[model samples]
Target: MNKIVYTLLIFLIFNHNFYATNYYVSNNGNDNNVGTIDSPFKTIQKAADIMSSGDICYIREGIYREEVIVSTNNLTFKNYQDEKVIISGADLITNWLPSDIGSNIFEASFTGAETQFSMLFVNNKRQKMARWPNNETDEMMMPEDVKTGYEDCQVFNTRSGKNGRRVKFPNLSGFPVDHFKGGIFRGIVGKKWINPMGIIESSNDTELTVTAISDDWGTNSSKMFTDNGKGFGFIFHLNALDQPGEWFEENGKIYFMPPVGKDPNDMVISAKNRKLAFVLNNRTNIKVDGINIHAASIAMKNTNNCEITNGSVQYLWPFFTRKGYAVSKTEQGGIFIDGNENLFKNMYIAHSWGHGIFIDGGRKNKIENCFIDNIGWIAQFTSSIQNFGDGTIVTKSTLGSSGRFHIRTNNKIDITYNDLYDCMKMGQDAGSIQSTNGGNWGVPLDLKGAEIAYNRIHDCNTLTDGNKEFVLALYLEGCFNYTVHHNLIYNFKTDVVPDGTFVYLGPRMATIKDCYYYNNTVWNVDWGLRVWNRENRGDVENILFWNNIIDGKANDGETSDNDRNVNSLLAKLSFKTNIRNITGNGNALFVDANQGDFRLQTNSVAIDGGTEVSGITDGFNGNAPDVGAIEYGSSFPDVGSNIDPEDISFELISDSSTLSTNSSDLKKESIVVYPNPSNSLIKITNLSNNYIEKISWKLTNLNGRELFTGKALTIDISSLPVGVYFLTVNKTKTFKVIKN
Candidate 1:
């Protein structure tokens, strides 16, 4: 009885643990226990710490100021009730206090030397003042001495009819009121000194104001100043605008203004410590989902099998620096997967300081259904950044940079069904989706058994002027057994001055087969397909170009230039011969000047055409073969009745010997079968072939997998499926059958 009870208890516990344990996180909670409905953990990192496999951590709506890192495997972090869970930086509060009286010291300099000057104050105790020179010359002059000098300066008064009065200085240039009293002069603004006078309501001095009448003083009253001296005092000194000052309140809101000579600090945070927001070192089978990760110097580094899905990562721009200044210090990428076999899906990563999704060293990794844009903005490659402008999507580093994809070493990597646009200025290293260099150690060396398919690559050469070595689509080098099929490449050349051509297959052992190059329209392009072999490796053999449609002409006029269409295809071959069935309406192939050892037979249809003999296939319409992409063939019929209709039905008829035996008994003497291809099973009611042994039948596909087998001739084949199949009889010849 006790054993039975213990077994029941164990089963209950196992069933209970199989279901996901739901944990809730809210900002209002203070406890760390994720067990209760009311009390929950305050931080995502705290919740992630205790989460086990098959656990769901539901976070509530609120701004979280902490960084959450999930190294747990198969754990899901989702929003509980609200999706707008803002994970932001820690807010630092800054308090400000007003400056006390006589605490600030102001001075003036003219041409790197201290000067003493005066101004006219018409509203002072003495309207007319005399100018004075300082008895002592000091680097830091007193405000009272500067004010006394300004009070003694000459002034010209002009009465405005009967309402107001105006005053002006006699001399306009020399000693132009270089010192001021009880006032702060701001930074210079367009050849004029900007000063801040004391609160006008508190001062007992007559409220005499001065105004200028020219268009020079039009709408720039905040920065411009006039020398009309009257009750209005002209105070001049070094401006306090550039200096760092405290935040002040005017109505009820606070405003921060810097003092003179003080520039705004644009460096918000320096990530020189190589601090990463999230680091995955030698980890596996970890999943990070639905988190906003931003503002780290390096967002993520050295992760493997780490799936990051349904999230966004963006780097914040520097606050007050000029454009392109602090680009190097910004965050590196949304996710940097260096290890092998990682999967990233449905992630929106953009506006990073570096590559959006950088998979440096990985094998068999898959990145699909993700939106990656606006990357490669690092300051190290300024020209490349400028070529990308503001619309860079993604980049593989390849400017003699140490960070390379290293695809040559690792195989079985698939990059498909993702929108990659607007990333120009430089091509990738070897084995990338597209590369620039075509030498032996060049681009194609990395592509061993790689598959490039089903992508829309257009408008690639938008920035063509700077780097003339740009290969728009792909540069094939040293690659072997790779496939480039079913991709839409159009409108690649956007610049007038052509930099580099498109699709160059270098001196490499590779195969280009079964690729549908239909509607691959190009304008102003130098060459459609350029293949060369300067490396003399002798391994550049068996490169096939089957079933491809080459439509446009080469921009170069020469029939056999490297930039010419057919010449580009022939430059890579060693012993060229007549291609089989290369059909097209336009000029398809061009042989190079050095291609003399190559020969085309009299029956060879590609005598004048440029296609190689190995590229052509036997499945063409012409007597021999046509030149380029278009194949001339007989018009296909409606594809009706490959077999006669009499072959559709099957029946079993009794022989004359069976009927002659007995009409009622119908002694099974002989049986005859007709109509080989039938929709249903055949009937074997009258078995008259007495000498025949047991009947055995088998149905198979072309590769010979017996789908259905039976001993009885009247087999119930209602379950036998439809397709072209073969039926074999053990007693007689095998018959080809079709089930419809």
Candidate 2:
């Protein structure tokens, strides 16, 4: 049992034992001595109230603004050794007076346990929350406009005046018309992915008018605008709290403006009353190691093999209410995983407003080696890991969400090797790793042995949701089959998400759904792959691109004279009919991939040139597999956390260690289509005539969808499935069969 609880936690830390199961916790101690370690206990919920089930507490150092309810289980809190500990949730603010400052505006007062707030930290940073086109600097959360890349997604050309609940805005002329009277707009209306904030019921300069305060704002056609669709500010309002760290609140006072000019009595502020800093309620194998956990979060209810290791879960409590409608569940702010097999390891999670780790369910949960960043700054489609569950196992985590949204799931997931980046921020048709095919949410997709291998997904940029068949990097829509390999999906912080961005291979129904996309590597990314079929429902005939290294470079968007490949996304979205199942070719060169280092340099053209596939290139280093997600003189596998690990298991990589034996590239591909009877159908034969008219083929299974593609040297695999399958060539060989 974990080596008998680490040998009784090494005999209660080298013999300081008395069998009360070690407790302590301090700021110099005293919740009534006797909690040992020279009698500590000044509230870590008073040693989580008389510790029990495998007890271990230990805390120590300082800063602990309460809220810790652990219905005990196999416990073990930790910290003592590092002596850093912290668990605050704001709540300091002592005295400000100078008649409550001004212009440098400052003031305080609010003790009814402080009425309400979304944030305000001062010395700990994070201030600005006023708003009204107000942003002299200190860029407070969203509203950075600057893209004359010819704006006009039509939302009425930047809102040209509305009706019912009125809107207007499309002029500026000397600003100030009661600075957005009693503010709160936060736009992006007429549904360009619902941004919603509303409630300005009155203004002038350019025109305003809103009231229904919520419920998607009582129609002006549900807050109209759609031609360049979203953009608006207004917010908070105390006459837009004029710059300098801004903040606002009225009546019972509480205003500020010190993000730097100091002396609100030499700053230390803090406001944001405790909101459950660490609950682990209904606990089980509990283990909140290494402490830290600032602005508060962490509520693993129905908790199970619990374990929140390492440290830092910073700032959290972001936007719990801006008056509702459009996104809720009290708008996330990180860490909320609900139960079973939990174990958020090596944590670091930051900012938050919308998920940094939501996964609100139970089942093999395991977001390992965490480093989650910024996060959907305002419920921006709750990516940054939201809705993950059912055997979820996002490994080696390093997820970053600059423009928001990075993961939206439907279930049975296994995302490995992680390092994901800026997802479709400002949101739209996103996909920094998004999944669906739970019949698009009516939930039911469990496509058996799934596994999106060796991750490195990159920038799914956004200039207002970068519309171009919607930005990319592993987007899977009607998700079929599923064993996407050795990942590396590439770049783009701009070039405005050009045509089909990257990897879309969707599949809804049309019977035969598969996916085993091979030895991956995709750079620059602008249609490096895409095989659609959603309308007139599914059928792209086995999407293929084996031993991949798919390349893409120069592009400026708006379909710069079409033809970006993957048979031009099935002949320019004219659905199906592009017949280009691409095989490796000069391995699309990389090594510097403009500096994201996609490995494979000297004599590049993809070293060992692919075709391994046995539980994914199992331990190979040369003369064979080598495409993306690192392996050209091997290295890059620590995508985020794992310095001596082993203890995971969340199902994938089905059986016989992935079968498929024998090779010399499988004796030059059994001549072709060879799988020794068992189901049937394979072609090529005696391979000569320069390998039968310069070979080219694409089947599909191993769960990545597509059954028989072009340059067809014959294929049928009669209803397929038995184990192992692959066969590239002239893009550069790759053969590996087995089946029976």
Per-candidate TM-scores read 0.45, 0.34
| Steric clashes per prediction | 27, 22
Off by over 4 Å in 1: 1-20, 31-35, 88-284, 296-306, 316-334, 339-341, 379-412, 425-432, 435-446, 462-471, 494-496, 508-524, 531-539, 555-740
Model 2 agreement with the true structure over 1-740: per-residue lDDT tens digits: 69999998888877643554878766656788877766667778888878876779887645677789887677788876554566777676656653344567777785523213556775355676666555555422344352211111122322323223555656433556655665665554444345555556667766666554434444434333444444543455677676677776567667777644455654456666776678886778888898877777888868888888887776675653454433344555567777788888887777766667777778888888887776766644667777647877889888775444566776677888887877655545556776766335322244455688888887666644333326677766666567787787777435554543656555434333455677776666656544444333454435445676655342222222242333323543321111123333323455466666766667765667666667777887877767555678776665755422222110110101111221122223223333233345555432222345556766555664656666766565656668777655544554565555
Q: Write the per-residue lDDT of candidate 1 for residues 517-573, one digit (tens) a residue.
A: 221212324455555433332234445443333324443222223423334435434
Residue 281 in candidate 1, Cα distance off native in Å:
4.1
Off by over 4 Å in 2: 1-21, 26-39, 43-55, 58-63, 66-86, 92-204, 207-232, 240-351, 354-375, 379-404, 408-426, 432-450, 453-473, 476-482, 485-561, 564-740
Best by TM-score: 1
Cα RMSD, model 2: 27.4
